[model samples]
Target: MAQYKTPGVYVVEKNAFPNSVVEVATAVPAFIGYTEFSDNKGTSLAQKAWRITSMAEFNAYYGGPPQSKFSINPLPAADPKAPPVTGDFSITDSATKQRTEYELKAEGTSYILYYSMLLFFMNGGGPCYIVSVGHYGDDLDADKISAGIDTLLKEQEPTMVLVPDAVRLSAQDCTTVQTNALMHCGFKMRNRIALLDVYDGYKDRQDPAGDCVGAFREAVGTNFLDFGTAYYPWVNTSIVKEKDIDFTVITNLDVLTDLLKKELSPITDAANPTPAAKVKIDQLNAALAAITSDWTKSQDPATDKQTLNKTLLAVSSLYPQIILAIQKKLNLLPPAAGMAGLYTMVDNTRGVWKAPANISMNGVVSPTVAISNDEQEDLNVTTQGKSINAIRSFIGEGVLVWGARTLDGNSLDWRYVSVRRTMIMIEESLKQACKAYVFEPNTANTWVTIKSMARNFLTSVWKRGGLAGASPDDAFSVFVGLGETMTADDILEGLLKVSILVAVSRPAEFIEITFQQQMQKS
Candidate 1:
C-alpha cells in the first residue's frame, strides 16, 4: 500500500499467490567429446558448452561425422580350441580354390563421438549441450576430457553428463573419466547424473581377460554411486548405413587392389578372354588407378570422390565386403549416448518418474554380446552392490534396455533410476521457485507462502503420477519455519531452510505369478 498524495483515492495491486515452481528439464544431457569441427561461422565452440536442438544444428555448427579408416589384414593363426573374435569373417578365392580368413582393424584410434551423436539423435534425443575438447584427429586425452566436464559447471540446463568418447581410452583412463564425471555430477554439481558405458563392453562376461562388469565395479570406486548408471554391453547400431561407406575408408588400398586383381585373374589370364570379361577388367583397372592417383590434380574433388565410389561399387565384387566390414566397425558403439537419448524420450513422453527400461532401442540392430537370463543376474545384481544395466535382446522384442537400477543397487533409497531422477526434478524445480525469496524477511509470512507454493507444484507432479500416493497430502510434505526446518540461530545467520519429503515411484522390476488347483465352482 503506497501513501496517497493530495487525498486522491488509490488502488494497490497485491499478488495473492507466491511464485510458482517451474520444473527444470530432466533430460537435457551434456555431451563431452571430440567433434569434426566446432566452428559456428568464425567463432570456435571448442571446449565450450554449446546447445543444439537438432542434428542439423549440430552439423552446421560442428561439421559432420569423423572419417574413420580401417585396414584389411589376414587373420592371424588361432588355436583350434579357441573361439574366433567378433567381426572376423572369411572370403574364398575362386581362382585358387581356397578360403582365407581376414579381419578389418581400425587404422588408428577411431573417433566415435560424431557417430555417437548420430546415434543419440536417432534414438529420440532432443536439445543437448556439446563440449568439443578438440577436433577429430586429436588424441583422446583424459585430462582434456576432465577439462571438458569442468566446462559444464557454468551451464545449469543440462541434467545428465555423457562422454561417449571415453570408452575409446584404455580401461584405466576410461575409468578415470567416469570417476571424474560421477564426482562432477554428485559432489560438485549435485543436480545432474552421469550415464556411463563399460570399457570393452562388447566383450562377453567370460572373456579371458576378466569380466567387464566386474572390472568396472572395482575401478569405479565407492563415492557417489547413486549419481551414475552404467550400461552393457555395447550395441550394434544401424546409424552408419552402407551408403555412407566407400572404398576410401580402407587404408590398405594397395593390398585391396592386389586382392581385387587376384580375384579378376581368372578372367584376365584367360587365353581367349570374352569381350564382356575384357570390358569388366578395363573398367575395374581404371577405377583402381583413379583411386590410387593424386586427387589434388582433379578439378573437382567432391564429384571425383562420388564418381570413384560408384565406379568401385559397380566394378569390384570385393569392394562390397570391405565396405560392409567398415560399416560394422563404425556401428559398434558404446551405449551411453543412446541411453541419454532414451532418458530424454522417456521424460518427454512419460514423466521423469517412468523407468527407462524394457523399451526397444532405435537404430540398434542387437547387443554386441548376447546375455542370457543367467548371465544378466550377475550384471543386474552384483555382490558389491554396483549394479550395471543390461541391454538385452529378446526373441521378438528386438534390442531392449533390460535393467533400471542405479550403481548403488543395494541402497533402497536411491536404487532405481526413475526414483533418483524424479527427486532431482522436484528438488531443482522448487529450488528455482524459492530463489525469488532469497533476501526476503525469513518470517512466518514468507514461510507460509513458500510452503503453499511448493505444495501446489507438487500437487501437479502427483497428478502426473510421479509420486506414489493416492492424494497430494500422502505424496509429499514440505516444512519450513522456526521450529520445523530452521531454528532462531539459523534465521539469525540469514539461512532460510526448507525440508521436503516425497515417496517416489519405483519400477516393478520383477513380477511373479502363482497358480494352484481349485475345486470346480459349477
Candidate 2:
C-alpha cells in the first residue's frame, strides 16, 4: 500500500516479492499551482494529490487546439512540365477571427520544399515553417522565414523545418528551445521549407521577452502528453478521406528523380567536357593573334616614316594595305580628315647647318649638332662661324651657344664656348643684354631660370614665324629635361610636380619638353 506524506505526485511500483518496496519520485516536483499524475495506483493519491486537466479548458484559455484531429494529404505529384500551383496558406485565429495570408510560390516547387512541408504535417505538426516566395516584402518576417527554410534544405538529414514569411522569428509567440530545436531539425532535413507562425510572436515589440513567452506557451501546448490542437492541412473531403490517407500518398518517385537528374546532370557534364579544352585553346590563340597584330603595327617603320620622300612613297606603295591597316588599327585619323594631307617633311639639301649640339638663342637645338652635345663643340671654327652667320642672317640678334666638347685636342668644352659666343653677340647687338645666371651646379633655382629662358626663347622664335607657327593654345604638354634618363619613379614624381604647378600657377601656356642631349643615341 502507498501512503502520501506531502501534497505531491509520486510513483509506487508493486514488487513480485510480498515484502519488497519500490518508490519512484516524480521527475519534477508537484507544481504549487496544479499537480498531475499519469496512472491511478492509489485512490487517495488520485483524489487528494493529482487532478485531471481537460483539453477543452486548456484550448479556451490559450490559443485554439493544434492540428491533432486533422491529417495531412500527402504532397501532390509533381508535373515536370505542368505549371506550378500558385496558392499559399492562410492562418486564422478561431477566437479572434484574425487571418493572415502568406504568398506561397512564384517560382516552381523543388522536392526538398515539398517533402519537408509534408513531413512536418505528417509527424504531428505543431508549428510549421512557411515562406512567402512570390513577391518581396518590406517586413523582416518574410526574410527570416526564408532564411530558416534555406538552412533546413542544406542539412544532410533534417528532422524539422522552418517556413518563410515576412514576419520575424522574434515576433512569434513560441518557446526558444522548442522553436530552436524545430529549426535545427528542419535545417538538418531540408532548409528550404519554412513555417509562418514562428514570426507571430515578434509582432510590433522590439524585445524577445514576448516572443520567448509565446514560444513557451506553444511548447507547453505542443507537449506530446498534453492533449492540444495538432497541425493538419486544410484537406478536400471530396477528393480524399481520413482513413483512406494512403490514396494521397504520392508514389511518383519519377518526378523527384527526374528533377534531381536534370539539375545534377548539367553540372557533371560541365565539370568534364570532351571538347572544352580544345575550345579554350582556340580562344587563347585568337587572343594571342590580336595582341601580336597590335604590337607589330605600333612600331612599324614603313607605316610611320619621318619623311614622305620618293623612297618612303615607294615603300608606302609597296605596303599600302599595311599602312591602311595600321591607320585603322591606331585610330590616329579623325573621321572627316582622312590620310591624304598627312605629309612627312624631308630636307634633302645639306645647307650650312649648325652643329646638332649647338643650343640656339631661341632655345632650339641646331639640326646638325642637335644629335649630340660632344659633336656640336667639335665642329671647326669655320663651321661654327657659318652656323652663327646663318642664324643671324635668317633671324636678327639671337644667341648661339657652343654646347659640347670639340673632338679637337683643345681642353675647351662647348658649354663655355657657347656662353662666350652668346655674350659676345649680345654685347655687339644689344647694349643692355646680360647673362642672368649660369647653372654651375644645377640647383632648383638654376633649373627654374633655365626653364624661363627656354620659354622666352621659344616664344620669340614662334613670334618670328608669324601666324604660320603652331598656335599657343592652352594645351597641356610635358617636357622632360636631359639632366638624366628618367626612371618610372622619377617620371611619376615629375608628373606630380607638373600637376601641382599647373594647378597652382594656372599658366596660360603649358608644355612638356625633354632635353635628351646627354642621353645615349638609343
Candidate 3:
C-alpha cells in the first residue's frame, strides 16, 4: 500500500508503470503535524515518502481518516455588511393583473439586514430590501454566489449591495427583501422595477455577463426619479420659517447702521487718543477785565450816584420780576411781614432801643387854678404850674380809674388766654424758626416767637380796654408789663419788645427809659 503525503485518505493502484498490477488498496490518511499535535503525534514522515497529487483523489480514497483530537480557537466573526430587509410587501402579477399583500418575516442573516434597515429608517434613510437565494449545501456554493454578487456590484457600481438571506431559500420568497435592503442603504427604489436573475449561469453553462445591465439601469432610473411629491418642506432642511412683522415703524437698517457707527466712533476715538479738557481761563480773564472796567467806571462818584439812583428805581419798579428770578434761583424768600418786620427793626436798631418811661403821681390836685401870662405870673398861679398839676391829675386819675375798669372787665381773662395762646404760638414758631434757620438761612423764621409774644401781649392789653380812654400812666403801665414779659437780652428779643411797647404806650414823650429795669432781674 502507498501512503498519501497529505493527511487525507486516498486510493492506491498496485500496478507498475506498464500495467503490471496485483491488488488495489487505499492509502493511509497522513497527519500534517504542527505545534498542536507535537505531544501525542510522533515526528512527521519525510516529504520523499509520499506522492500525493490532488486533494480530490486523496479525499476520494482516504476521506474517512481518523479525526485528530485537537483544540481549535474559532476565528473572530466577520462584521458582515448586510443590507436591510422589508417588513411587508405588495406584489402585483403582470399577467393576471392581480395584487397580493403579504407581511414579511425576517430570519437568520436576513434579521441583521432588517436591523440595519431599521437603523437607517431611524436615521432618516428610506426603506429597502433583502435579495436572498435558497440554501446552498456547501461553502463553495456560497462563495460562488458571493463572488458573482460582488462582480455584479463592482461592474454595475450600484448604489446598494444585496446578499442572500440565510433563511429564505428561494428568489421568489425574498423579492421584497432585496428591495428593502437597497432602501436601507440610502438607495431610493420606486416607480422603476428591478429584476433579479437567479439562475446559476456558470454551472448551467450560460453566460451572465450582461444580466445585471437592465437591473442597474432600473436602479439608476429609480434613484434619479423626479418624485416631486415626496419632497416635503419641513423635512431634510433646518431653515426656520418666520411670520411677517411690520418693520415700517423701525428705522432702516442702513440708517441704524450709520447711527451705530457714529455712536461708536466717539468711543473708539476716546479709547485711542483721549481729548483734553477745554480751558476757558483766557476767556474768563477777558470777561473779568470787562466786568472790572465797567464796575470801576460805574463806581465813579458822579457816575455811581446817578447809576445807583437809576438802579434803585429800576429795582423798585421791577421788584416782582427780580424777586421771581431770585426765587427761581434760591427756591425761597424771607418772610414778608410780621416776624420779618420785627427782624428788620432789630437789624436796624443793631440790638438796642429806647424804653418808655413809667409815670407815677404823689397826690391829686384840687380844682382849677387859672394861669395868666399878662399879670406878673405868681409861681403858684402860672401856666407851667397848672400844667404840672393837670399832668399829675391825669396820671393819678387815669391809673386808678382805668386800672379799675380793666380789672372789672375780666382783665385776668385776657391775661390768661393771651399767655396760654402766646406760649403755644411761641413754642410752635420757635420750633419752626429753628428748623427753617437750619435748612434755609434766607427763609429763617427769625424773631417769630418774640414777635408773636409781643403782639399777643399788646393785643390782649388793647382788647382789655387798657389802650382806650386811658391816661398816659395807665398806658405806661400796660406797655411796661408787655415789655417785661417779652424782653430778652438778645437783639431780636429786645427789638420785638420795644416795637410792641411803642405801639402800646402811644407815648407823648419818647423817653429813653432803661431796658435793664424792664427785663427780669436774674
Highest TM-score among the candidates is held by which one? 1
Tens-digit lDDT string for candidate 2 (459-480): 4423433112244322112242
Model 3, 1-522: lDDT tens digits are 565688986766753222111111111111111111111124432111122333333233223111111111113323347433221233333445544332312112211122222222232222222222211121213433333333332221122233322112343333333333334222342211111212221111112454321222232223211110010000111111111111111222233223223323334435444332112222323322433344445547455434433432232222222222222212111111111112123222321111101222111121112223222122112221110101112323421100101001122222121122222232333333334223222211334443444445434444543343354334423222234444434334433322332222222322376654476768
lDDT of each: 0.89, 0.25, 0.25
Model 3 lDDT, full chain set: 0.25
TM-score of 3: 0.12
Q: Write the per-residue lDDT of candidate 1 for residues 226-308, one digit (tens) a residue.
A: 99999999999999899888777888889888888877888888999999889999988998898888874788987888888
Off-target runs (Cα >4 Å) in candidate 3 are 1-386, 390-446, 468-498, 501-522
> Would you list the rank order by lDDT, best first?
1, 2, 3
What shift in Å separates residue 126 of candidate 1 from its native position after superposition?
Answer: 1.0
Tell me the TM-score of each prediction against the true structure.
0.95, 0.12, 0.12
User: What are the per-model numbers of colliding residue pairs?
Assistant: 0, 79, 18
